[model samples]
Target: MSAPSESSSAPRAVNPVLAAVAWLWVLVPFGYGLYQLLIKIPALFGG
Candidate 1:
């Protein structure tokens, strides 16, 4: 078998704290929107 290629090598690592913050950056607003939807859904259903 041929040796591994550069493109096929393992990917670089990321900072864990930065990753967590990036995820929260996206997820926090999504979570808040979901929470607001849950609060409004019952109003739409009339109960």
Candidate 2:
């Protein structure tokens, strides 16, 4: 026999505040990187 694992537990509801924080954590860096890429793109094309 095997011991029960975390994935064997029932699903839980996500906390909205935590979800928002997680999104911000991911998006802030992504937005900054995208902004940097956009600024460089024009230079790449010699615009």
lDDT of 2 by residue, 1-47 (tens): 77888688789987899999999999999999999889888877788
- lDDT for each of the candidates? 0.90, 0.91
Candidate number with greatest lDDT: 2
Residues 1-47 of candidate 1: C-alpha lDDT, one tens digit per residue = 87878678679877799999999999999999999889988877797
Residue ranges of candidate 2 with Cα displaced over 4 Å: 1-12
Model 2 global lDDT (CA atoms, 0 to 1): 0.91
